[model samples]
Target: MKILYINAMGPYEAWPQAGVFVSERVAALRKNGVDVTACSYYQINSPAVQRVVTRNGGPDLGTPIAQQAGVTYGIRKIPNGFFSAAMQRFRPNFWEKRIARQVRRDMEESKADLIHLHWIWPMGLGVMRYCRETGVPYVLTCHGGDIYSDMKDMRKRPYILKMLEGAAAVEFVSKALLESAKELGYSGKNAAVVYNGIRTSVFYPARQEHPGKTVVGFAGVMILRKGIDYLPEIFRRIQELIPGEIHFYMIGSGVLREEIEKKMAGLPVDFLGTIPSEKLAERFNEMDILLLPSRQEGYGCVIKEAQACGAVPIGRDVDGIREAVDGFGSLIAYTGDDDAFISAFAEETAAYVSGEKPIDRAAMEAQAARCSWEERQKDSIAIYQRILGKAD
Candidate 1:
């Protein structure tokens, strides 16, 4: 089957980590003998876009663009400068039209049997319109931000609902996300809960030799949505209880890094800015515990990544996170309750440090196995086949 995958940003663009996930999914589908082509807009101001412009001539309008792995990319340059900034601030639809025109051109050239849209914001409206007009089937996947934030905007809700109404199938990364869509009055057909998976080959367990030290770590974007601001107080309480026995490591970067550092001043925390994917397994293995205190998570893929390396995850008891840590790790209080969260962290840390509670390497591995890319691929392929009326 010829399939077209549409996303806002992937590996070589604005969000490289998300691009890695998309690359893995495409690789898995190709391995199963499916023909998949991916298309993404050129993310303005991203390092990857800068590199592309430096190496190749900037993207041309209405042309078949670059290729990565086996997937073809259609790159379009959006309007820049003061006028573009005004359009973005006053009329976001101006940008969506450019996205739609490019996507329509790409779809016409590829003649794909199906389209799978990754997120439902600017891209979805355009792609869904093209699919509706051209009589092609497309599936929409709500990957966190669209459902959590974009859908909350009154101006965007109608467009979002129209996309859902037009899609052949709608996939959510977690059950919590599916419920959120429903609560927003999305009475769509053929909805499914498909959790994001980890590449086990890259994220599996390793033998660590850190002796006499319990390392608690946080991995992912250090943004407010991640509840990173609360880390300082939590760490302070942990240190007050078990000084010198525990150490903190944060493995990622974002806008709030400086503020987080300021709050965590004089603490035992080490900021290990962003680590590459190749070395992530080693970092995960180094941690005795991985903390994911997200205020709102779609599906914390890092939770599974850390667990694959045998780092027990302790996360907030919120939507998608609660499910990710259900059978594998500990769930503390909700995002804002610092006292309850601190109490839970201190208790769990004390138990692990004192040898009263042991890290179950076997159990963590088992959970990771269930959430691996191979398993996710199986579900995704089945969804594709079902949508195509080719299911056995």
Candidate 2:
């Protein structure tokens, strides 16, 4: 069966590291003789776009390069200027119609059996429109921002809900997100939870002898949602509990980076700036702990990656993160309360520091190893087969 995998956030060639997760899934399916062709919206990485894009983080939308994976895909550039970019802040109503047309054209030309859409957005709405027109089925995967952040807009809520309800099947990265969708008014019967996996080849236990203080790492767009604002309080509490016991290294850049850096000045923190995904594992290897005080998540991919690299995971006891840890890492502070978050961090790490319950790096690696792209691919293909009624 011809399978079309659509990524709304990428032209994968430019997204490199982030793109690898999708490419790995495609490659795994390909190995099983399942025909999967991936496609993405080509981002125009110009100076004007850079101003907006970097506001959230660094150039995650890097320059589009030639596909080095030896597999070609449908890569269409977003044909819009500053105005279109500004307007698409809440919904891509303008250029999305053209993209929707492209999705239909791609499906028709490829004779695709099904379409796998990454984000249930404005783009997913377009795909839904196409599916209704052609009677071709499409699966929608709801990543974090699409549901949590996008759903807040009353104008876009109807479309997101429709996409959730109209999907041939809805695959949520975390069970909490699935429930969130249902709470937000989706009575869909055909929904499932498919946890994300890392490329094990690139991420694995690689800890060396680092004899200094315990190095804690934080990676992702530094913003309110990621709990960047909690840094000062969290750090103060951790230090009060275990003085001079931890040092921090932060990755990714965002609107809060400068303010956070300034606030964290004179502290044992190093703002490493935004590192590429390919080299992320190297940095993970240097850390003894990975701290992600995120208020929200869609299956903390970074948490798993850190676990795979032998870093003890520490984060909020929230939705996707809860599943990502899978009883392997340390999770505390259920509420967004600063004191509770701080106490949880201290309580969770004190044992390790005191040698009462020291970190077992090997076991952490094993947890991550248990579920990977290979396993996720099998589950995904099974779902696809079920959807298409293809026993083969």
Candidate 3:
């Protein structure tokens, strides 16, 4: 089957994380003998874009776009300048201002059996509009921001409802995400709870000699939504209760780095900055427990990455996160339950590091298994076939 994949910022923006996901899915489809092609919205004209493309070569548009452009997730790729300007000029939802003639022309040029949309916001929304105008069948995969943002805000509500009404199928990364979609006015017959796949070969479990000191770490951007601001409080509480040696590792670079450093001054923390995707596993293996205290999460792929490295995860008990943690690690309250969270963190940390409760290597393997690219693509292909049959 021939597929035309659409992602507006292109793959260059949602790299390693979102970019890697798309690349692996396309590879799996090829391995299964399905032909896939992609059309990206952003121009691959800059050195920044070219460098990442060189690092991670791609006949597939998504992976190269992300690897070179540095877009890790949907939230990171909210284009601010010209892209945003164009969006304002051509309002996709308002029928008076239909999809641009160029987008429709492009879709027609890249004729395929089906169109698979990765994230339905900014660019994905435009692609969907083109598909609708051309009568080409398409599917929308709900990746956090697309669904979660729609539920809380009215601005994107109509567009999301239209997506539900028109899509051949709807996909959510976790069971919680599925529920969130339903709550957000998606009453589609083809709703599916598909977990994102992790490349086990790239993010494999490693046997590490744990230092006597337990290390708690957070990897990813330094941002408010990630709940990095709460780290200092958690660390201070843990220090007061747990008498054993402890260390903290804060990974990744973002706008909030200065604020995080200011809040965590003089604390037992190692700010390793941002490491390349190839080197992230080493940092995961170094941690006794990985903490993700995000206020919102689509599904914490990092938890899966951490679990793959045999690092226990303790995260905030929010939507997709609870699904990710699901007994593999501890989930605590998002707010107002700091004491409870700190206590649970202490228990899980000491238990794993001290070997009081044997880390379930099998469960870790099981979680990683759920995220394989093959499984993700198999479901995607099946959906494509069904949509094509409907077109017939």
Candidate 4:
């Protein structure tokens, strides 16, 4: 079956680690002999648009049909905000009508068996409208922000609700998010919880190279929400308490990088900036433990990826991480509880180093296996086939 995975976001080269997971999952599906196409609205204006694409790695729209794992992708040169922009200037009636007509044309040419949408908002809703017009089956996977943040946006909600109403199935990464969706008027029958999966083969546990200095690693967007700002103090307290060498390895960069650098000024922390996701396991092999004190998370892929590589993760107990970790490594206080986090950081790192409780490679591989792209793609393919075979 031909499937079109629709999203609006980024220059695939700069995609976040999670984007790598999604891309690999789609690649896995294609390897299983499924026809998959992607429509990424990459390089769009607006912070919301960027967040979606950045989170999902706008697929390689420039990929040739063969290079794209039997998938073709395109970037819409026309941004989706002309109507809202024109609304401020003059009557938006003509522009609004034109958008509907153009959306219909795009859908017909694509001719997808199923439209699997990620991040249902203004752009996603357009896909929903086309599905409704053509009586095509569509599914939406909510990855936060779109539903939780923009649900109240006037133009956004109507489309979100329409998408919800028309979707053959709806998926959220977390139970909290699923609950949020139910509360937000999504009463679809096939509403289900599907956790994001990872590539365990590429991200399996590795042998530790450093046994002398206790290394605490972190990877993800270096934004305030990730609790990167508190790393300086956390490391300082760790150094003082342990009185041993405590090295910090931070990966990824964002708006908070400059400010975080200012805060950590002369500290012993090693900021590697952003490295490709494929290289993370190598760093994981070097590190003693992974730290992700994020204020929020959606399946904490880094936590899983690190754990898969035998780097025990110390994360803030919230949403996806709480569910993903499931008593694996250390669970600290929510991002606000700095004191508790510092205390836990030292204790956990010590335990990890002294072999009090080493990361269980067998258990981690087992857990990681449950969330693999191969497994997820199987379920996804089933979801598509079921949707297609359903009575219209």
Candidate with maximal TM-score? 1
Which window of ten consecutive residues has the lowest lDDT sum in model 1? 57-66
**Model 2: residue 25 alpha-carbon error in angstroms:** 2.4
Model 1 error, position 250 (Å): 0.8
Give the alpha-carbon lDDT of every model: 0.75, 0.75, 0.68, 0.67
Candidate 3 — which residues are off by over 4 angstroms? 9-19, 42-100, 242-245, 339-343
Q: Please give, for residues 1-392, the per-residue lDDT of candidate 3 as tens digits.
A: 68776554344333334344555666677777887665544533344544554566422233334332222222222223444334644553542123334456555665676777677664556656666777777777777766776445676677767776787787777777778777777785788776777667667766566556677899876767788877887777667755678889998765678888999897899998766655778777777789888888888878888888878898888978887776788787745776666666656666666677676866775677567667677887787888888778
**What is the clash count of model 3?**
10
**CA error at residue 8 for candidate 1, angstroms:** 0.8
| Model 1 lDDT per residue over 115-188, tens place | 88887777776777677777778888887889989998887787788888778888898999988988897985
Candidate 2: deviation at residue 55, Å? 9.4
Off by over 4 Å in 4: 12-18, 46-72, 80-106, 152-155, 335-337, 355-359
Task: Report the C-alpha displacement of residue 190, candidate 4, in angstroms.
Answer: 2.9
If ranked by TM-score, best first, what sequence of candidates would result?
1, 2, 4, 3
Model 1, 30: alpha-carbon shift in Å?
1.4
